[model samples]
Target: MLNGPLLVTERLILRPPAAEDFDAFAAMCTEEETMRFIGGACSRSAAWRQWCTLAGAWHIRGFSMFSVIERSTGEWVGRLGPWEPDGWPAPEVGYGVRASFAGKGYAFEGAVAACDFAIEFLKWPQLMHCIDPANTRSQALAKRLGAANAGATRLPPPFETAPVDAWTQSADQWRQKRKEF
Candidate 1:
């Protein structure tokens, strides 16, 4: 089993999701805008299942999204980290911040932490962001991270039909590009 580690960034703590984070997770997952890029807003029960799945991914694959906690307020602001499950096109350092947490650079900072963890701990050779084509914010973020749209790939159904872009960067590219961050 993989023990979650605390990843300290300048303004956030990237740690594994815990039982107590369910409420925050629920709030985020239930918001239409917050989930617009991923799946649409879902029921509370559905959110719980998603939360549990993220937590379970750590044990299953030795890596999963870290619950991004604001170090100052100690609130669970988002989820960001390494993610790769069966059927995924590639290993990814993904990030999703709550609606209120958006525009504060939490996603960027947390993703940087997660990327560091993915490279150092998970030892992935490359990383990808399975992004929706219409999500301009995510597109900008991916570009900022030096990830370019490498190709097209389908997500698992019912999202299979959604326009998914494969944004990617090699380990060496990250090492070179990360210097700017």
Candidate 2:
């Protein structure tokens, strides 16, 4: 099942998502500010389906999104982990923090944990964090994870409305930069 409590950070716990987390995931995706850079609200059904797909990916490929939780309260802050987005050259690292939790370092905590997993566990040679140029916060987060500005790649035509720019991190690069943490 490739399932269990996988990794932990200073303030976050990375685990597989549970059914009860659907509501929080949907709400986080629907919030104005929380979702502003990622596109529009995702329907509740869509969110659950997405969550299932994330878990399914783990069984199928051995890696997928980790539901991020607050260690202190056990609250579902959001998700952070790795996935192979369609057309991406490598598994992309992505994350989202619940609206109320944004700006509180949860995203960074979860992201760093995911990056560590990608490097240490998955042993992926490369990772990407595609972002909208206007999404400075996410871009900065990518930078914090040791991803460099890799420039834009064409948005899959279906998502013509989405932004471009694929920030990339090599395993060697991550190992070097991660020492600072």
Q: lDDT for each of the candidates?
A: 0.87, 0.80
List where candidate 1 sits over 4 angstroms from the true fold. none
Candidate topping TM-score: 1
Q: Which ten residues in a row have the lowest lDDT in candidate 1?
A: 1-10
Residues 76-165 of candidate 1: C-alpha lDDT, one tens digit per residue: 898888888677778888888999999998888888778878877778899899998889999899899889999889887667788889
Models 1 onward score TM values of 0.96, 0.91
| Number of colliding residue pairs in each model | 0, 0
Best by lDDT: 1
The RMSD (Cα, Å) of candidate 1 is: 1.5
The global Cα lDDT (0 to 1) of model 2 is 0.80
Candidate 1 residue pairs in clash (backbone atoms < 3 Å): none
